[model samples]
Target: MKKKKAALLIALVMSTCTAIAQQKTPKAVMDQFMDKRFGMFIHFGPVTQRGTEIGWSRNDQVAQADYDSLYHEFNPRLFNADVWVKTAKDAGMKYLVITAKHHDGFCLWPTAYSDYNVANSPFKRDIVGELAEACKKQDVTFCIYFTVLDWHDPDYPIHNPHDTTQSKGLGGNMTAFKTRMKNELREVITKYKPFMLWFDGYWEKPWTTADGKEIYQFIKSVDANVIVNNRLGKVNDKLDGDAVGDFLTPEQTIGKLNMNEPWESCITICNQWAWKPNDPMKSLKQCLQTLVTSASGNGNLLFNVGPAMDGHIEGRQVKRLQEMGAWLKLYGESIYGTQGGPYVPNETYGATRKGNKVYLHIFQRKDGTLSIPALANVKITKAYFMNGGAVIIKTDKDNYKIELPATLPDENCSVIVLELNKDAVNIPVIPVKA
Candidate 1:
């Protein structure tokens, strides 16, 4: 009887230890990712030469034969890793996540596992290596974006109609495919030792929860400190709490406020993820607002920049980023190293908190006064504009109001810094009227 009891206790202890290990990411790595709320996403591939979307334009925009033949003509002599990392740095971005491999199965780095890489192109340079070195030099975290669904791989279970060859179908050598992918990933991790692995295109037919867990474990084995996203096919950005992977990636969309899990909204500066002629760009104000919203929601923003065929970010796009950077220079305090909330964001504005201060981000300008519901217990000590000017604050039992400047603080989203008596402010949830 004592032997059985000892065995049960041992089992319980082992399970508890396993659960703790799985739940906790290396604090240093997770803190680095979470603290850096803004990052740069570079989506450059051979498809950019045609001024079309990567991977998706196989048939509609360009013929499959033409698409496959792009590597022969691929040349980005002007490509400079230093300039790429500098662009991100100038924009106040703390990290960069570049496409190591897109769904087109085109690898940026020369991979022995597959011949479909930049090594075969006219460029013949290791783009990933160059960029990783640049990022390290610039004190920027380097991460890679890898896609699981491959249109070029014959072993990949799913077949897009645009592909020149059809797969043997669902029962295709999935085990071999996974092995090849893991091997390639091992090469990347072992070589570059990336800050994080941002995965996408896992919503395919062949991928399963078990596959995600296995891949996640494999990555952990390689570098226990490296961060991984939730797109490993096990969980998604929507599901929080016990979701597998380090962070949630809500592609092209901003996450809701009060998110319990770490998340990032990957959005494009222009409409397309790849370079195209005359592509409309989001305004400087829109860009800052997006970052503000993401921070207010306790999430990160991986703003994407698609480099041109010549490997240069367009002058117009560069100008927009610099303009946004200028704003961040002045009012970045409302963001970086802050936690979201104390007030749920409405269409009008959002809020972020740091230590004993709560920052109210006013999106829409009000003439005389700006008011929002407040927690009854917490006291608002003083209020002032982040850029400049002091304001009178009034607090009632259930609401707080601030006096606005005659002209709103810079045209974009103006931040009002409020000193709080305590570190925590509970923002009471108010139900929406349908």
Candidate 2:
């Protein structure tokens, strides 16, 4: 009898512990993402307009000098910084990351180190400067995507043995190369003071972990607040999907499950990473569902819309984002500033909670009810679709379910709000008797 009582007591204690853990708060993912729930990832260059891969040559190849000549004629006068920043604002995005320098080595700003920049173009003006000014006007956090591997620069080579052209002007100390690159970093960070430095091209041969460390340390020392991506290291396993980066960056899809730290999933609405003409845009419903799915999974969503070479966002991308803004502006309470809650069974809807109330996002609504079996000792007091006013929840304790009305308001992704009041507070717990 004593052994049986001990086992039962242990079971009860374990059950209570599990309940407490279910309510535990993870990292400060929301605090980092509330203002950054959405952001624009811009991929644009002269190559983007030419219908070519952003930097890769089609054949074994084009002459470096010939390919580099594209920038001389690279003129994007119609590139409206206001339109680009406004599109992000209208789309409910508060941050923007633009490719200040792609692999091709053409600088958007006039760098003192390189003449291969926007200043040399017929449209001789600093586009990045304009973008910084525009983001400041609209209160959007502006960031730079810098690809350290520069193919067009005379100092750096492509690093492929098969191509002899890649080996030119190659005799230089790695320390000198790092020091020179650090100069560009200082120039950009000092001038624009970017919110982030999206460093890429770790595999592009010039970048080494040692080289990256020099750059990373330099930037952080300048402004400790700037958030650097995990690419600076050999992809951090913690922040990368496999613990890499400062945070997890799931490219082009909603990611696999992670509860340790924050995650951001980025996907393009169109086929190309950079702006393409008349590209088919994702529907308003699709965009809403993507954001909902990401938010419910305890992750942030960064929706990508490539800007045209003219520097303005595609019209379709702009319109769809505006529609998303309108919907989120109306029904965003459940998503923004909430934590994912409870070990909900797979069949029921996913949940996000704030204080006593929990939100149920019904991706696949059942015929009559949406149930939550694990939430016990709590009484649900309210129910309603997000866009419409209040409704009621007809709960059955025996079945452990919350019955919905006959029809759902939004078919694509309907959200139900449930206000729950804990019953244990009303009655003291009595120790179990064996």
Candidate 3:
């Protein structure tokens, strides 16, 4: 009996030690990603100004051959890497992720893989190189976006043999394809080391099964600390791969991340990935709220902006992004270095908390006070405009109310801070799924 008792005590001690270690474990890398609430997603290549999608000139009513050949003719005389970096910084973006190579197989920098990059083009300068250097100089985290599937590579497999333009990662020699893909991947990793690697087009035909795993392992061998998205390839089960990169990145939309692990939502300012002469961009208010809403749900937003052919951002897009930066500058306390609330508000509002402070973001502000009826225990101490630094709050017994101000500091949304001594004790989050 004594021996058994000793064994039990030892087991308890080990368990306690393990629990303490787990709690004390520092999530540094993950924390850095979360702290940087905003980043710039660039989708610019030789195909811009041609008025066609960068990679899909073949069947998408775009000049496939001419679009592909634009790399040789590529020369952004007005291209200013510093200006781009400055714009992103001014817009509250802590990081910038650019497309080193899109699905069209046109390389932005000189690569030994093929003669289809900037080296062969009229633009003798290396755009990605300049951008990487600029980002480092400006204290911005740099990331690269590479298309796993290429449409223009001659060896690339295509179902329709007669259609030269439609061959987009359709049918290629698996062995040769893997080698060439790895070569480009190595070039990107070696030439310009990045904080994140956002991979796209893995869902195509041959990138699945063992081929996908092979590429995944190949990537890890080079940069194990690099973050990768779950969209590595298509699997029968969940979006699974060799787990080459860190983080799961979602494109186009935002909502409650249904994945078990960490995830992010990357959306665009306009409809197309490449900059169009006239494209409807998301409004200032929409961009601002979208960011906060995404953060509130424990996910990051990689906002995209496609630059014009002359290397200039659309004024409309720039204006809105700058506005977003100004708004973040004011209410950034609730965003940067913050974690997702255990209970998120539904339609009208959402919740994000850091340490002792819980930020009450009013997406849809009511007249006098926003009623947080569900938050029975939360005593409202102060409410203020995030952009202008003005306190606005009202309380009455157990029923605390939000006293709104007449003028809105931000044209978009309002950030309200609810000061409380303690957290909402055992509060049930009522997500309006309507």
| Candidate number of the best lDDT | 1
Q: If ranked by TM-score, best first, what sequence of candidates would result?
A: 1, 3, 2
| lDDT for each residue of candidate 2 in 366-392, tens digit (9 for 90 to 100) | 667554553556667766677776765
| Ranking 2 against 3 by TM-score, winner | 3
Stretches of model 3 off by over 4 angstroms after superposition: 1-27, 159-171, 235-245, 257-260, 342-347, 373-400, 406-409, 423-434
Measured by TM-score, how close is model 2 to the native structure? 0.79
C-alpha lDDT values of all predictions? 0.84, 0.68, 0.72
Which candidate has the top score in TM-score? 1
Candidate order (lDDT)? 1, 3, 2
Pairs with backbone N, CA or C atoms under 3 Å apart (clashes), candidate 3:
157-171, 157-172, 158-171, 227-246, 228-245, 228-246, 383-392
lDDT of 3 by residue, 216-244 (tens): 66776676556655555554224334443
Candidate 1's TM-score: 0.91
